[model samples]
Each structure stands twice: as C-alpha cells, then as structure tokens.
Target: MNDVQIRTFQVPGARLHYEVRGTGPLLLMIPGAPADAGALAGLAACLSDRYTVVTYDQRGLSRSVLTEPPADQDVAVFSDDAHRLLAALGDEPAYVLGNSGGALTALDLAARHPERVRALVVHEPPLPELLPDRERWRAVFQDVYDTYRDQGAGMAMGRFIATVEGDGAAPPAMPDPSQMPPEALEMMGRIQGNLDHFLAHVLLPVLRFEPDIAALRSGPVPVTVGVGAASGDGVPALSARVLAERLGVEPLVFPGDHQGLATDAATGAEIIHKTLA
Candidate 1:
C-alpha cells in the first residue's frame, strides 16, 4: 500500500474532507448515498497501489460543511463540488467513478463541464428518466419520503432499502420506527435529507436534467455505464441499461446490486479499472 493522506480543503461554498492514496493518475470515487466515505474505503485500498485514489465526504456529510445556503439538492451542486475538488487537488480531466446518485452527479459534470472529466464509469445510476414509467418511480420515492416525515426515519429507511432491493411486489415489512437505534436513526436522517433534496430539486426536474444525449454522443470523453450483476431485474439495473442505450454504449456488469461496490470494493475497483482502461 502506498502512503495515504486524509486532508481537508475549502471548496467554493463548502469545506470538504478527502482521502488520497498512491501516486498515479487521479481517480475520483464519488459515493452514492450520504453515507460516510468509509463506504468506499475498501475499493480505495484496492486501487491505491495503481492510482491516486481520491474519495471525499460530500457537503452535509462527515467533515464536509455546507457553507452555501441550503439550495435544492440538485446535480448541479454536486457537479460543482466535483469541479471544486478537482481544482483544489490541481487535477483536471481525471477519471471519475460514481455509484447511484453519485453516478447521476458524474453524468451531470461530464455533460455540463466536459473538460473536468477524462473518462466516466457510472455504476447503476438511479435515473428515472431512463425508465419506461418514470412517474411510477417518483411516486415510490415520494411514498418513502412521506413515510419518513410521518412515521419517522427507521420505518422510512427500512422501506426504502427493501424497495431498492426487493422485487416490485408489495413493500416489505418496515422496522418499528419507535425502536430504531440511535446510530440507525442518524444514518436514516442523512439518507432522508438527501432524498428530500433530490425529490425537491433533481427528481422533480426530470425534464430539465435529462442528459443531452446528443451532446454526449458528440463529446470525445469515453463513458461507461455499469450495472451490478446481483441487482436483479430492478430499477437500478434497468436504468443502467436504458442509460447505456441512450448513450449508444453497451452496459457493463459490476459485482453486486446498488450497494455492491460498497460490499465488494476490491472486485468493484478491479471492474471499474478495467472499464476505465
């Protein structure tokens, strides 16, 4: 393992904490959920020997302070954060890998600010636009949001996780909202915040955020869409496939479902490296 350093920097409107390891071409790993950067630690470790792995806690996450007014949590803010992080690190046109919501952010950056992105490996982005019935997905997300607001975080989280992982049958049994442990509730709050913001800004602005597929088609940057083999026949995988088709590229398979990269980071890193290469 190469020497690793965890450092903090002030982006334009936020304070960001990031970890850098190894000494090679830069590779930025953007985490999906508002969960800790620790989610990507295993994959970072696996890639540290071969690349300068950069992982950060995004705004509103650990060690990162949101100094800007609480704007709608849109992909634009996330893209700006990526741009700022790259500028702060003195690396432009770096390889980027994004999972789920982070993947959406990566696409936004690549589409809006092409110069900052060298190549993009997007894994299972939850892009509703790619779905045949995007409104249905939005409704599902809305239901989860309502669950959080009314029943509290635990019930909301359990339902959301189950929905993401389960077949599109009846929603699975929810955990007792009253009995949620402190840590679980804390994590749920983080997810709830992101969900609320996404619903308000990104999800609702589906028409506006629709990627300029035509622009992407004309752009020079190489983009790869990836889906987890274990994702089942669900929205994540379906969305990935649809995005690939829209991009006029084939969909690549990673290790697991939406959370697969977090669970099998080494394998995930290897797959991503291969895609980038």
Candidate 2:
C-alpha cells in the first residue's frame, strides 16, 4: 500500500492541489469538468504499484485554489499547467491520461510541448472540430448553459449529464434534492457553484477550438485515443475514433462508459498499463 501525499504547486494564478502515490514513472491523471482529484482515486490506487500515480484538481475546482477567476478556460493554459506540473516532477517525460476535457488538455500539451509527455492516452475527448454534427452539439451545449442561467443548477446539470451520456434513452428522473445523501448534496453544491463557470469558460471554448493535428502527427510522443466500449457511438466516442483515424492508430476500448476509471478501476488500469508498457 502506498501513502498519499498531498502537495501544492504554485502556478502563475493558481495553487494547484496534486497528490503523489506509488513509485516508478509518473502517470498524471486529469479529471473531467465538475470532477476533482477524488474522481481518480480508484484508478490511482489500482495503478500505483507499477507507476507513480498523480492526480490533481483543476484550477478553480476542489482544493486547487485560484488567485483570480478566469474569464475563459483556454486549453493552452490548461496544457501549460500540465507541462509545469510535469517539470516540477523532474526531467522524466510523464505518462499522461486525461478523461473528457482533460483529454483535450492532454492533446494540447502533446501538440505544443511534446517533449514533456512520454505517452498520452486521451479517453473520450470531445473535439467538436472532428465531428460533422458540430453545429448540432454547439446548440446542445449552449442549451445546457442556458439552462444553468435561466433554470438553475439542478436542471442544468441534469441536461449536461443527459447530453453527455448520449444513450438515446431518456435521462433518469432526478431524485428529490431533499432526499439525497450528504455526498450527493455536496456534489450538487459544487456543481451549482462551478457549472456557471464551466459553461461560460471551459465547455464551449474547448469543444470549439481545434487541436493541432499536424503537430500531434509529427510529434515525438506517442498518443493513444481511448474509447469506452459501453459508450455507444456517441459524440465523444466518435470524436475518439476520428482522432485515432487522424493519428493512424487504433482506439483502445475500456470496460465501461466515460466514467470507467471510477467505476471499473482495475480493468481500466490494466489496459492503460499495457498500453503504456
């Protein structure tokens, strides 16, 4: 068993909260929007034996405190943050994994600073530029934002989750806010406070911006696009396929849907370990 040590890195505007566990090559895992380091705890525990697993709360979320509120969440800024964190770890090029928006950041990092990354596994990155229905999703994401502003957090989050699941099945009925467990309530609070920030700053900007395909293709680092087997050909899964096609590499299928790392950590870790090895 490895001890989890919490540390803080003072980047320009944010003091990022990161954890280091296990011992070996560093594997940095970035969580999706609205999820923090806690989201990666299970996966980190599973992989820590063979690799030094690291996870962090993105700026303005969880314990990663920011000096000022950012008006727009730029992928480049997020990538730079990842780059600085890797530099802080040492000269070794770290293995990186990003789920959803984190995947977008990973792609950005590989595109700009290929030397800092050894192998990047991007699982379910939502790149609008690659999809033919970019306009439709643009409207869908915007509706989520509108729900946040016009309706409220509960409604907005419901829509956001529904849109991402993209299972064609109708979303499950939202439980009464009052009957929820303590953790559920707490998460809702976090979502309520952060959803506006995420929609206004991160969501639209990241999906709309195109990653440097030419740079990724020519870079020295290895990039693996991962898709969840259980996630039907949703937008994110399709995005992964398109990215793999562009890179001329096959997509790695994991056990569960977008939240596989949290749901089925052991299997997800094994697949990732083999891929990196």
Against the correct fold, how does model 2 do in TM-score?
0.91
lDDT of 2: 0.84
Residue 205 shift from truth in candidate 1, angstroms: 7.0
After superposition, candidate 1 runs with Cα above 4 Å error: 168-209
lDDT for each residue of candidate 2 in 53-162, tens digit (9 for 90 to 100):
99998887767777886768778878888999999999988999999888988899888988889999999998867888888888988888888789876787787777
What is the per-residue lDDT of model 1 for residues 119-209, given as tens digits with 9 covering 90 to 100?
9998887776668887877787777667767886567666666556657644434567789767556655665555544433444343234
Clashing pairs in 2: none
The C-alpha local distance difference test score for the whole of candidate 1 amounts to: 0.74
Output the lDDT of residue 102, model 1: 76
- Candidate 2: deviation at residue 184, Å? 8.8
Every model's TM-score: 0.84, 0.91
CA shift of 102, model 2, Å: 0.6
